[model samples]
Target: MVGLTLLALFIRLNAQDGILLYPDSYQFLLVIRGLAESIPLDAAMGAGGDAWSAPFYRLGYPILAFPLHLVIADPETAAKALSLAAGTAAVPVVYVLARLALRSRVAAIGAGLVTALSFSLANWSNFVMPEATAVFLLTLSMLLAYLTGRAGRAVAVAAALTTALLVFVRFEMLLVVPSLVAFIALGAGQERSKVLPAVRLYLTSLAGLIAAFALALWWAFGGVMSGLSVDPTSLFQAHVIESTTAAHQGAPALSGLRDFLDREPLLILAGGMGLALALRRRPDQRWALWLQMLPLLLLYGLRNDMRYFALLVPALAYASGLALDEGWAALRRLATSQRAAPALAVSATASLVVLTIVFWQTDLTN
Candidate 1:
């Protein structure tokens, strides 16, 4: 299934429609090409003043593309290639995460296929951005932290490194690390003695990550404070925080849930059902899922942009796959089992294919 998923994504991504998908794609290409031309990192910018440091996004994507820029000659092609590879690699990682969490082969494969075929997901691969890579690393980190009931130091270290790298890939990933630590600590099983050590290891790894990020920033920006100040404090502002927590009138609150439902109705229905199922049957997994999704949720509520919703697709797809798989299973037991099972599977598969095409077309036409 993993191999097939990879092939499917590769074929899709490799097909060029000659559309420059997003503004970010052009910026990424500029950065990659500039760096290849020996332009300083801080000086890498687009013709339109899209600076490398204006809002202080992570540098991992451009840095990772340097070798590709050197080898591929065309910066856009290199960037697309990078996204394609990262997005393709994420399929197996998504499978591992779903399989580990649900302990169900059908659910895991379904998740993998959903992720692989998702137009929103595959769209990332066809573009020149870090989202696909970020998704891949983020899912890998989640899997590493949860694969065992009690993770050892090596697993903790690996998970931490993956997460830290993910942060470098995209700064928003930083928001979820604390919750991830909590998730890792809970994975230490029921042994009280093992719990403290596990917590210590995860925290220490987190500290190491922070220090590494600080050092990288300091080197790039010339000082820790300077690097930190690249983005204004307003960057942290959100409608939920402003309305409910801070009760500030500076920015009007908005309904992210409503916007998501309006934009991606199918995903909202299936993913919401999946989420309810998780809350009911796999309460232990809820924290991790929330952490994975909360940043995007906040972004949606604050900005009301549907584009950020793509970041939540991995969790949504995983949850939806579980719901779809289990729902079909229960239906099979209640009726003419074999025939109903095939019918349900066929219908679900067809629905997914149609949704994928629709999403791709929508994004492209936009």
Candidate 2:
């Protein structure tokens, strides 16, 4: 935990040279500054001084940074501070999930280290975007899912609430709702008699919260569809799905895959090996991991935004840690001679370090 905290602080403090604002960061800054004004709803303005509104972006991140902005009086620093704090909080959450679900302390520590150094996630801590917060929320959900096996109604309710709040951070988080429910069901399987009761309690709480949220939006906007600016399609009154999807269409799906491979080849490769290992050794956890990864897979296949890739960092890191541990065990078995074992261990560590450097350099060069 001390190591994780130091790594998080280092990443946060060393993201950029000077100015922390990026293209997306500035967009969020506009919203945050707008919210600081007396009339927040219509005060949002872009760099061009034109009125801007982002209904799909969610107000959660802005609200969190508003107080900090007031104190610091600098939009960029305030935004970065909020993101840094959220990203830092995610370190422990990832560790706990890896420990409980993967059942390996070494894997847990590796998970924490990987998450702290994840380029996509760490870089965003310098931005005003909500990606860091999303990572934290997702990790918390994973942790809760793992704990549901031993917990009762209170934990179930807490899990439901945490998952529910994720939607306010990113609408894509809604995909996790079904995944969380299935995970809780898997946990409930331990107690045959209590399975239905557990699932019912979880599902009921999640649904009720979502229903209330929808109703509030409906009343505020005259209709839920109105809040999203619905557009009619040529066919049978079908509404066009509008959000950030258009911005994601510029890049090809294969391009995103290539970028991920370049940025974190070892992590991605080890994660795949770990996935297979988990499937064989721990089928229950393997399924939960897959559930969490579904959104990232879909995004890669469809939208292909690198920023969206932060969603998979925690899961990939956890899987990579497991794979690394397995590789060490396999190498030890392969080296039958005591002298050969020591030599192989040194070689393996050196090779991983070299590979990490090469991948990071290649990713940056690309």
Candidate 3:
């Protein structure tokens, strides 16, 4: 099943870069190209010619893609390779998350299926963006938090460090770190019945966060070889704030959200339905749901367009799965007394409507 998901993931891979949607991807490619061409990592390349040669592109993607310099001839080919690898790595992480959350093979399989078949993953799996890598790390990071009880502090620390790397992969992920920390702290407190152990564990995990920041600095500032700001909040504010603030950005946050609400009302209904399910069982799971929900959820009412609200896809899809699973369970019980078909029909119709609109919009964009 998981293998099939990877196959599904691989088939959607594409090497194209379109700056109109988001220009930073090309800049990243340029950075990798510079390293491939043996350009001095320190020298700042002008934004017009090769914006990527600057220090900000120095993150882990270059390190991971370095081997491509020796092999792939085409620049796009090389970039695609790394992106594919990252997207591929995310598959098992989703599987692991499913196993941890549901603890049932069928449910885990279902969860993994929902994650892998995500149209967003399919569309951008091979696109020259760090989204796949960042998402992979995000899933891993969440998995680590979910597994905090079973794993030792050292393991949790390592997972936190990986998530720290994700912060560089995509700045929006940083928003979830607090919820994630809360998730970890709450779990630790419950297990040991002491807050100090959880505190120690949480602090130890900060090492990974520090390491991630150091790597990001090196990537952005040329790893001690160039001059660039190392401040953490720089990218976060710029990408999420300024880009969205652009007068007519492709994915304007609020307007897009309004369009979604006005057009595809079902997705919102589905999300609400899913939230209700998560709320019902394992009240403790509420925080995990919230941790997974926050970063992308806040953009809901603000989405000016579909693409602008894209960050919500994975999180929402997970919610959809939760809703689907929970809804089905309730329907099963409802079947004994009343009509389960109506509930099933409603979820299916809502999901189908949402998917259809999104797919149509995607084709129109193409």
> Of the candidates shown, which would achieve the greatest lDDT relative to the real structure?
2
lDDT of 1 by residue, 217-267 (tens): 556544322323344243234212322332233534454444555555455
TM-score of each: 0.76, 0.80, 0.74
Write the residue-wise lDDT of candidate 2 on 69-93 in tens digits: 8998887778788888888888888
Candidate 2 global CA lDDT score = 0.66
Tens digit of per-residue lDDT, candidate 3, span 211-268: 7577664664364334334454664444555334543557454676665455434435
**What lDDT does the true structure give each of the candidates?**
0.64, 0.66, 0.57
The lDDT-based order of candidates, best leading, equals 2, 1, 3
For candidate 3, the per-residue lDDT at 137 reads 73
| TM-score of decoy 3 | 0.74
**TM-score head-to-head 2 vs 3, winner:** 2
Candidate 3 all-Cα RMSD: 4.8
Clashing pairs in 1: none
